[model samples]
Target: MTEQNVRRRGGGKRKRQRGRGEQAMVPDAEFTSYYGRPVVKASPWQADIPAYLFLGGLAGGSSLLAAGADLAGLPRQRRSARLVASGAIAGSLFALIHDLGRPARFHHMLRVAKVTSPMSVGTWILSAYGPFNALATGGELLGLMPDPVRRSRPGRMLGVAGRPGGIVAALIAPAVASYTAVLLTDTATPSWHAAKRELPFVFVGSAAAASGGMGLVAGPLDESGPARNMAVGGAVLELGASRIMQHSMGIAAEPLRQGTAGTLHTAATALTATGALGAVAVRRSRIASALSGLALTAGSACTRFAMFHAGQASAHDPRYTVVPQRERRDRESSPT
Candidate 1:
C-alpha cells in the first residue's frame, strides 16, 4: 500500500530511485486500484450520519453559549442554552448508537479509550459533555420551575450547580463542533479528504449559526444579543468558506456545486443569507427574529446534509480520484 510503481513510463518500466540524488517530486501521491475502482471502501453509514453531525454541532454551540451567558451573568440565556445543549447532545448520542448496527456496541468502544481513533475520542468528549449538560440544565430547571416536591434540598442545590456545570461543558464544545470534519477527512472520500483544511471552519460556522438561531427563536430579544451576533457572523463565515473552494479545488469541488448536493447547498446559502440580513433588520421584533432563526436553523441542517452527500458522490466517481492525481503529477513535472 505504501508504494504504487508506474504501470508504464513512455516506452520503459519505471524504477524507484531512493536517496541517491535529487529525487522526483510529485504534487500528489499516486496509487492504483482494480478495474479503475476506488482503492478504499466507501463508508456504509446510513442517513443517520449527517443527522448525527448536525446535532453534535448544535450541542457544541449551545454548550458554549450557555457558558458564556453564565459568565456574563445573563441567567436566562445561560439556562436556555444549557437545556438545549443537553437535549441536542442526547439526541446526537441516539443517532450515533443507531449507526453502529448494534446499539450496545457503543459501550464496548468506551471500555478502552484510544486517542488514535477519532470516534473513540469523540465518545470520551461526549461522555463528559452529556453529564455536564445534564447537571447545568437540569439543575437550573428544578430550581427555577415549580416542582412537585416543595422546598427540596436537591432543588436548592440545582440553582448554584449550573454555574460550574456549564463551564465544564463549554470547555469541550469547540472539539465537539469540529471533530466530525476530521473524522470525514481521515477517510478515503476524495471530496472530504480534499477539503480537510476548510471543512472544520465550515462546520464550526454552521454550528454557531444553528445555536444562535435556536437561542433567538426561543429566548427573549433583550437577552439574545449574543445569539443575533453569532447567527450573522456564522452564516457569513460558512458561506464565505464554501465559496472560496470554488476556485481552490478546481474540478474536485464540482461535487459540492452539482447534483443533489449542489441544490441543497445553494438553498442553504440563500436561506442563511436572507436570515442573516433579516436578523439585523428585525432585531426588535420577536416574531421576525423567530422567523429569521427558523430559516437559519433549516439552512444549517441542509448544509450538513449537502456536505455528507457530496462526499458520497465523490467516492462513487473514479475520475475524481484518478484525474486529480494525474493533473498534480503533470503540474509538478513541468518547469517553473
Candidate 2:
C-alpha cells in the first residue's frame, strides 16, 4: 500500500499516530531514525581522558621549555618548568588510572606495543616520559634543600642525576603533546574523526598556552617574557584552529554548539581571549600575570572537555553519521 494510504487507513497502535514517509532528500535537511539513536558506540573515555589531555599537553610543553631554559642558562625558569612537568604528569597519570577503573590493569596496557595502537604507543611514551619528568623535578627539589643538606653527597648527586633524563624527555615531549589529537581522531566519532587534519594543530597550540601560562606563574616575572609571548601565540593559534574545525565540519559541528559541549566551548573561548589579552596588556604586573596564567590554564582544560563532549554528542546524533556517509557514497558513485 502507498505510504499515504497506510497512514490514512489505520494506526499501528490503539492510540498512537502511524508512522509517516521520510521527508524528501534535500541539501538542507537529512532524515534520522526515531529518537535519533546513535549511529556508533559511545566512547569509553570519561572525565579522565579530557583531564589527561590537558595535563599531558602542559607537561609536554613544559618539558620542552625546560630543556630550552637549561641551554639558555636560565636556572630559575628551568627549575619551574621541570616542577610543572612533573606535577602535570602525576595528575595525568592519576586521571588515566581513575578512568581505567582498575589501576593494576594499566600494566597490561604496555605488554607489547604495535603501530596500529595509539593507546599502546602512548602508554610507552608515558612510561618513558614520566620517569624523566620525575627525576628532573627531583633534581630541582634537591637543590632547594638547606645549604648544609644540599652540600651532602646524596644531595650533590641528586642535583646532577636528572639532567640526562630531562634531556630525553624534552626530545619526546612534542609527540606526547600532539599525539593526543591522533588518538581522538582514530576513533569513530564523526566530529573528532572528521577534523583529524586540524585537531593536532589545535592541541599543540593549547599545550603551548597551558605550559607557557605555568611558566608565567612559576618563575620570576622579570624572566617571564618568553612565557608571555608563548601564551599569546598559542592562544591565538588554538582559537583559529578551533574556528577552522567548526567551519570544516559543516553540519557535523552542531554538537560543538549544543548542550554541555556548547557551554564548555564558549567558556574556553572567553577565557583564552581574555587571558591572552591580559598577558600582553599587563606584561610587567605579577598580579596580572598570575590571573592571566590561571585563566589560560582553565581555558586549556575547557578546550579538552569541549572537544571530548562534542565528539560524544556527535556520535550520539545519528544524523551526523548517516548524512556524512550518504554524501560521501553519493559523491563516490556519481558519474565522473
Candidate 3:
C-alpha cells in the first residue's frame, strides 16, 4: 500500500511541474522607458539650427564655385558666386548666434580647439572661411561700385585681397559643408548616429546643389555650364546616399520616412530631381535656369530641416533607441 502511494504521488508531482512550466509563458516585454519618459531627450535646438545648417552649406558650396569661376575667367559668375557666399555665410552666422542666445557663446566656442569635438572643429572652420568670404564679397562689391570708390585705398586693398581670399575659402569649403553631418552624428540621437556614414555625403551633395542653383540664378547663361554639372552631380549624390542610409538604418530610419520629416524629404527629393533635369534640359534658356536654381535652393533647405526633425523624432521615441541596441546585442551574442 505505501509503495503504490509513493509512486502515485511522484507521478502527480511531475505532472504539476510540467503544467506549471507550460502555463508560465510570459509575453515579450514592450520597449518602454522609465515612467513613460523618452529614453533620450530630444535636442533642444530650434528652427534656427536647421537654418544655420542650410545657410552654412550654401555658403561653403558657393565659395567653391566662386573659386572655380575665377580660374575659368568667368568674371560675372565669379562675382555672383562670391556675393552669394558672403550673404549666405552672414546669414548662417546670424542663425547660429541667434540660436545660442548670445554672441558671446560663439566667442566662447572659439576659446579652445578640440579635434574630438565636431562643434569646435566647425567653429574654427567657420572662422577661417568667414573672413575670406567677406574679403571676396567686398572686392566684388567694390568692383560693382563707381570708379571713384573702386580707386580708393581701402577699396583697392579689399579688391586686391579678394581673389586670394576666395581661393583660401574654397580650400575650407568641404569641411564647412560636411561638418554639420559629423556634429549631428556624434549626438546620441538614434537616426543621426545610425546614418553616420551617409549623412555627410547627403550634406555635401545638398551644399553643391544649392550652390549650383545660385550660380544658375545669378550668373550669365554663357557661364552656367559648371553650375549645371554641379547641380546634376549633387542631386545624384544626395538622392543615392539618402536612399542607402534609410535602407540600412533599420528601425532608426522610420522617422525619416514618416510624419513631418517624410513630407519634407519627399519634397526635397522631387525638387532636387526636377531642378537637376531642368539645369541640363534647359541650359540655354535664362528663365528655365533661374527656375531650376530656385527649386534646388528650396530642396536643399528642405533636406536640412528634414534631417533635423527626423533626429528629434527618433530621440523622442523609445523604440528607436532601444530596439536597435537590443538587436545589435543579439547579433553579437549569436553564433557565427
Best model per TM-score: 3
Please give the CA lDDT of all the candidate structures.
Answer: 0.83, 0.86, 0.91
- lDDT by residue (tens digit), candidate 1, 1-336: 122443232222334577675434443434445676775567799889899999999999988988887787788887788878888888888989999978788888889998988888888888878887887887777766776532577676766776788888899899999999888877888888888788898899999989988889877788989888888888899888877755666677889888989998999898898888889889789999999998888889999988888888888877678778888999999999
Q: What's the TM for model 3?
A: 0.93
Off by over 4 Å in 3: 1-23
> What tens-digit string does per-residue lDDT give for candidate 2 at 170-215?
9999988998999999998999988888999999999989888888
Question: lDDT of model 1 at residue 280?
Answer: 83
The lDDT, on a scale of 0 to 1, for candidate 2 is 0.86
Candidate 1: which stretches are off by over 4 Å? 1-40, 147-150
lDDT of 3 by residue, 107-138 (tens): 99999999999999999999998988888888
- Candidate 3 global lDDT: 0.91
